[model samples]
Target: MIDPVIIRTMKTVKEIRLENARALANEGPAEFARRIDSSTQQVNQFMGPSPTRNIGDKLARRIEAAFGKPEGWLDVEHITGSDDASISGTRSAVLEKLLPEGSGNLVTWETPDDLEPDDERVWIDRYDYRYSAGNGVIQWEVRQKKALPFDIGFFKALGVRPQDCKLAQVHGRSMEPYLFNRDMMMICTAKTRVKDGLIYAVTFEDEPLVKQIFKEPEGALRLHSYNPEFPDKIIAADQLEGLQIAGEVVYRSGSGLAGGN
Candidate 1:
């Protein structure tokens, strides 16, 4: 028989999971499951009424890491007061951490000089070139469309320098679900080294493509697509000369795109 203490602890963990689910309601269960490196079914089962499974130590750590929470954050309950001021303060604190200064109160600044020094915002160039995720496409010419502002802290958290990052749109169904058609991707040019299972923007035979790269033995490389409908492309050691890795895809913003493990 399971110990009563163990049962109570499991129940408390389940309750905490429920609270986290509520907090991440905007991302939905599927995204949350993806972030926690777990399947949707597992998330639903543990978060369900009268859950049959308990969140193990490994899964709890994954959840904390995925959500930017501290270690063992899920092991205890966080109490929030019923007062409106307390709730507002909590929300403000979250926003402050996630957003740049003065972002909470938006105002039109005629020039960069009008912005305050504490803004800590970095502008990333949004190139007009598209990286094909299906069949490769030639980048005729590189042109800067505009600069998008992002919090400097955000880049620091991702371990990417602001200047080394460039924004481009993904154009193909091959990388779908994770990278949909016209999804904006942030590529860290400094990280051109191939890391297995990580998605990258690359140039193959003068055509730019976005795909997950896997380094094989004998200096060969395999380009993989998220959509199973698209078969993986293998580049032999001899053919590697035609392949040029632009950068690692650090972030993607689009509909239904979730954080990958």
Candidate 2:
């Protein structure tokens, strides 16, 4: 016998999740996406206004930067963060912390950023791949959203678990002729062993960069740029944080090059 009250409660929760998902796709700002007017109203709707946009807020910014521009509360739920808003937290919350190490990849796919709301694809996949996102949370039917033909960001972080993250979008042409501006690349974040030659994502002087990797003896990691014009950057293996191979470039997309523009 189905309990009507329990079913109603489940429906309410599902409705909220779906409504928020829709808003997220349309507005690109989870907290501000609800057109309910007034900050207080928005806070009440979300149940937590955020203390000056701290952890969850920071993760939301990253989600917008990495995936699609924010969208709904639940959309940000499974992104990069320690709270329910982050991808990790969302799955943990609904799945009740069932995320184990070495699970499948967790890439986020979504509808195009410029698509119109009425466009059947308005609901993008932006974050968390089909397999990971469906671990046991969202219903099987609701999981049918297929982002655009442009799903991407595989590389090292594609499906690499929570701890190990080697991800950074390419900037400048220093590694040019090979990797131009806006070209995204990922490296293994584990920093396991600085083998001989493995490209890594390097952060030097607070500046993040992606370049070919090389590790030398005496505990020193080297960075070799493909563009002959740019000189190589080197640092000690222990100091590898600045020269660690976050992950390798597994997939690239955008424009029209398959990964396109």
Q: Identify the runs in model 2 with alpha carbons over 4 angstroms from their true place.
A: 1-168, 186-193, 237-245, 254-261
As a whole number from 0 to 100, the lDDT of residue 225 in candidate 1 is 92
Per-residue lDDT tens digits for candidate 1, residues 52-165, read 466778877777888888997877766455584466456546544654454433434665677677668897878744444333433424476557778999888898899888
The Cα local distance difference test for each model comes to 0.73, 0.42
| Winning model by lDDT | 1
Give the best candidate by TM-score: 1
**Model 2 TM-score relative to the real fold:** 0.34
RMSD of each predicted structure? 15.1, 20.7
**Would you give me the overall lDDT of model 1?**
0.73
TM-score of each: 0.54, 0.34
- Global CA lDDT computed for model 2: 0.42
Q: After TM-score superposition, what is the CA distance of residue 170 in candidate 2 from its true location, in Å?
A: 1.5
